[model samples]
Target: MDLAVLRPGELTGADREVWRALQSEARALGAPQLANPFLAPEFTLAVGRCRPGVRIAVVHEGAGPVAYLPFERTALGVGRAIGLGLSDAQGVVHRPGFHWDAQELIRACGLSVLEFDHLVEGQEPFGSRKFPVFGSPVVDVDRGFDAYLRQLRARSSKFVRTTFAKERKLGRDVAPVRFVHDERDPAVLRTLMRWKSAQYRRTGRSDRFAHPWIVRLMEQLFHTRTESFTGLLSVLYAGDRPVAAHFGLRSPSVLACWFPAYDPRFARFSPGLVLHLRMAEAAAADALAYLDLGRGAKDYKNSLKTRELTVHEGMVMRRHPVALGHVARRAPVRALRHAVLARPELSGPADRLLKRVGRLRTGR
Candidate 1:
C-alpha cells in the first residue's frame, strides 16, 4: 500500500475520483459518517475557513484507493478528525476487512497523537480509550410519526403522556403551533444565530455563532443537496413568529442533529423540546431510521433516549520525546475530565475551569 498526504487545496482530479470511489464503498458498507456529504471536499473547505488545519491522508493499494482519513493537525502534533466535537462519527474511511494498524496510520500522518471525540464504537484504530459514554437519543422514524408515538407510549407511557400534555399546554397558553420543514427563509437562520449566541452567553461559553465563516458555512450547507442527504432547516412558529429552530444534515436514513436553538422569550414553554418532537414527526414522514441527537449527557437527551451507544475520544501516543512530554502535561487534565465524568457533581466547576482556560487560550 502507498500513502499520500494532501493539503486542502492540493486535492486533484484523481484525488476527487478516489474520494468518490471510497464514498461509494462506504455507502455500500453502510458506514454512516464515512459516506456523509459533510465529509466531502467542498464541505471540508467550508469548515476549513473557520478551522484552518484540515487535511487528508489517502491510502492506496496498487492503484486503488483503500482508505481515507480526514483530519486536522493542531499545534504540538495533536491531530483530530475534521469536524470533531460536532461530527457524530469519526475515523478513517476504509474498505471492509482492510486492517491497517492504527500505529501505522499515525506514522503515515506523522502525527504524534491522533485524537477523536466521536469515534464509532468498534471502529477505533487505536483500540478503546477510557472515556465517558452518554446516551445519544435516537427516534426511529421509518414507520412515521404515529407509529413512533405508539412505540414511545408503549415503552414509556407516562413520559410520552406528560410531554404531549406539556405540548398541548404550550400551544393553548403560549402560542399556536406551526412547523416549517426545509424552510429556505434567511430570517429563520438569523433567528437561530441570535438564540444560539444568547444561549452560549448565558452559559458563559464562547459563542460559535460569532464566527463569520461558520455563519456562511451553515447558510451554504442549508441550500446544498445531494441524492442521499440534504441540509434541513426546521422552525417552529408561534403566531407566525419562529420561536424554535434546528439546522441539521439529513440523509434518507438519518438526521444528524446539529445546531438547535429556541427563543428565550418562550423558555417557559420549553420550545426546544417541543421543536424536537415536531422534528421527529417530520423525520418519520421522511422515512429516516434515526434522529442522531449528538453526544453529551443532558437531561433532555436522557428523557428521549430509548437506547445508548458508546463513543470515545483518546489517542495512542507515538514514542517521540516531545509527544510524551505533551501527553504527560495533558494527563492531569484528562484525569480531571475522567473524575468529573465519574462524579457528575464535579462537572460544574470543572466545566467552568475549562471554559475559562479556553477563553484564555482564544482570547474570546
Candidate 2:
C-alpha cells in the first residue's frame, strides 16, 4: 500500500475523480447504507477551502486509489479528523477490504496524535479505547412522510400530537405557515449564524460560527449545488415572516442536519419542530431516505427520533505531549457531557444554566 498526501486545493482533476470514487464506494462495512456525505470530496474540499490546515491522504493499492482519509494537521503536528466539530461522521473512508494500521497512518502523517469524536461505526483499527456508544437519532422517511409520521405516532403519540398541534397553532396565530425547502437568501444564512451564535453563548457552548473560517465555509456551502451533495437551507415562514430555519447538507439519500434555530419570540409556538416536520416532508418528496439528527442528548432528539445510529468518540494517538494535551483538555469535558447524556434529571438544570449564561453574555 502507498499513501500520497495532497492539499485539498492541490488535487488535480484525475485525483479528484479518484478521491470522489473512493468516497462513493465507502460504506459501513460494505453494508447497504448510503455513503456518508461528511466523507465526500465536496465536504472536505469546502473545509479545505476555508481552513488551510485541511488535507487529504489518498491511499493506493497498486495503481488504484482505494481510500480517502481527510484530516487537519496543526502547527504542532497534532492532527484530527477534518471538520471535527462541524462534521457529524468521521472515519477513514476506505473501500471494502482496504484496512490499514491506524498507528502507522498517524506516523506517516507526522502527527503526534489524531483525535476524533463522532467517529462513524464500522471504522476499524482506530483504537482499543472506545467511548460509550451514543445514539445519533435518525428519522427514516424512505417509505414517505405519512408512513414515517405513523411510525412516530406509534412510538410517541403525545409527542406527535403536541408537535402537530403546535404547528397548527403557529399557523393560526401567525399567518398560514409556509416551509421553503431551499431558501437561497444569504441574509437568511447570516440570520441563522447570528441566532446560532447567540444560542451557543446562551448555552455556554463554543459558538462555532465565532470562527471566521467556519463562517466562510458555511457561505461557500450555501452557494454550492451539486448532484451528490447540496447545501440545503430549509426555512419555515409565517406569512412572509421567517420563523424557524435549518441549514444542513444532503446527499442523494441522507440529510445531515447541522444548525437549526428559530426566533426566540416564537418559542411558545415551537416553530423549530414545525421546521423539522417541513424538512421531513420536503426531504421525503426529494427522495431522501433519512434525516440524521446527529449525536447528542437533547430532549427534541428523543421525541423526534424514529431510529438511532451509533457514533464513537475517542482518539488514536502516539505517546507524546500533543496526545497528552488532547487527553488533558478533552477528558474532563467529555466526562461532563457523558454525565449530562446519561442522566436525564441533570438535563433541565444544564439547559437552564446554559440559558442563564447566554443571557449573561447578551447582557439580558
Candidate 3:
C-alpha cells in the first residue's frame, strides 16, 4: 500500500468521487453510521477551506484507492480529527479488511500525534487504544417516524406527553407553532448563531461561534447542498417569532445533529424539545434511517433515543518526544473525565459545578 497526504482542497474531483463511493460502500456493508455527513468528504473540504492545517491521507493498494483519513495538523505536529471539536464522527473511511500501520500513517502525514474524540467504532489500531467507550444516542427511524414515536411513547410516555403539551401551550400562549425543516433563510442562521453563543456562555462552555473560522465554516455549510451531504437548518417558530432551531448535516440515510439552541425567553415552553421532535419527523419523512444525536449525556437525548451507537476517543501516536509530551499533558484531564463518566454518581455533581461556574463566569 502507498500513502500520500494532501490538503483537503487538493483532493481531485476523482478523489472526491472515490471517497464518496468508499463511504457509500461502507454504509451499505452494514456500518450505517458511516452515512454520517460529518464523515463525508464535503465536510472535510469545507473545514479545509477555513482551516489551512486540514489534510487527508489517501492510501492506495495496487491500482485503486482503498482508504482515506481526514485530519487537521498544527505547525507543532499535533494532529486532530478533521473539524475536531465540531465533528462528531471521526476515523478512516476504508474498504473492508483494510489495515495500515498507525505509526507509518502518522509519519507520512508528518504528524507526531493524532487525536480523536469521537472515533467511530470498528476503527482498528486507534480503537484498540481508545479510552472507555461512550454511547452516542441515536433515534432509529428505519421503519418511519410513526414507528419511532410508538416506541418512544411506550418507553417514555410522560416525556412525550409533557413535551407535546408544552408545544401546544407555546402555540396557544405565544402564537401558532410552526416548523420549517430545511430553512434556507440566512437571517435565521444568524439568529441560531446568536442563540447558540449565548447558550454556550450561559452554560460555562466556550462559544464556538466566537471563532471566526467556525462562523465562516457554518456559513459555507449552510449554502452547501448535495445529494449525499447537505446542511439542514430546522426552525420552530411561534407565528413570526423563531423560538428554537437546529443546524445539522445530513446524508440520504443519516442526519448528524449538531448545533441546537432556543430563545431563552421561550425556555418555559421547552421549544428545544419541540424542535427536536419536529426534526426527527422531518428526518424520517426525508427517508433517513437514523438521527445521530452525537456523543453526550443529556436528558433530551436519553428521552428521545431508541438506542446508542458506540464511539471511541483516543490518540494514535508515533514513537516521538512530541507524542509523549502530548499524552502526558492530556492524560490527567482525560483520566478525570473517564472516571466521572464511569461513575454516574460523579456526573451530577460535575454538571452542577459547571453550571455554578457558568453562573459566576456570566455574572448571572
Residue 264 error, candidate 3, Å:
1.5
- Worst ten-residue run, lDDT, model 3? 123-132
> What's the CA error at residue 345 for candidate 1, in Å?
3.4
TM-score of every candidate relative to the true structure: 0.85, 0.93, 0.96
Scored by lDDT, the top model is: 3
Candidate 2 vs. true structure, TM-score: 0.93
**Clashes in each model (backbone N, CA, C under 3 Å)?**
0, 1, 0
Residue-level error in angstroms, candidate 3, position 346: 3.1
**What is the TM-score of candidate 3?**
0.96
Off by over 4 Å in 2: 23-29, 32-34, 345-348
The pairs that clash in candidate 2 are 202-358
- Tens digit per residue, CA lDDT, model 1, 160-264: 777767667777886778888888888888889888887776666778878787788787778777665577899988778888899988765668788999987
Rank by TM-score, descending? 3, 2, 1
Model 3 lDDT, residue 26, Cα: 72
Q: How well is each residue in 177-256 modelled by candidate 3, as lDDT tens digits?
A: 99999999999999999999988888778888999999999999999998678999999999999999999998888899
